[model samples]
Target: MDFRNLWPSLDLIIDAGPIIQNQGNRNGSTIVDLSVKGEYKIVRDGCAKDQTVKILKEFGLKEIHD
Candidate 1:
């Protein structure tokens, strides 16, 4: 997924801290940290095939998947 287009206004923040132990299935789960909004977890499931889209929508960001 191209995050640059997905979150155009926000900058990605990478934390060098120790990886947090993820609970449950890690297959399609991703943890993203944004500059202004902090961290958000996008988990893909049967009900929600495109979790990133849902997250963007939740934050009132325009959907621009690449």
Candidate 2:
């Protein structure tokens, strides 16, 4: 029941409810929040830039100066 070891990869999302329940530390931040808020934002925002790389990669648009 190690919640620390229940992170989801980009290739798949595993259900970590049991582990979190057993560990008794449900802050309600599920795997989706972890990936979407943490890793997804990192790749999207470039982590070193002020813009979203995902916008350029997905739509071939340049910097949105707004």
Candidate 3:
């Protein structure tokens, strides 16, 4: 789960658990956080979104329809 390079200059990272939460599994919320750039630069990086979703799927966070 080394996503450092994926999100370079990451500052504040908060653990969101497992991306999914329910009555049976409330402790499985995926890690989502607010990252800020150190310098005054504008960089559009899509790796974070892609990698996060991939990681969630890898961790068995299946979508439920009820």
Tens-digit lDDT string for candidate 3 (1-66):
777696767655545444443434433333443232222211332324445565645756543222
lDDT of candidate 1 over 2-57, digit per residue (tens): 65666767555533444334454334334443323433433333222355556656
| Cα TM-score of candidate 3 | 0.26
Task: State residue 40's C-alpha deviation in candidate 2, in Å.
Answer: 2.1
Question: Tens digit of lDDT per residue, candidate 2, span 1-66?
Answer: 565555553455533234233234333333222333223323232122322344334544443322
Model 1, residue pairs in steric clash: none
Per-candidate TM-scores read 0.27, 0.18, 0.26
The numbered model that scores best in TM-score is 1
* Model 2 stretches astray by more than 4 angstroms: 1-12, 17-24, 31-39, 42-66
Would you list the clashing residue pairs of candidate 3?
16-29, 16-30, 16-31, 17-29, 18-28, 18-29, 18-30, 19-29, 19-30
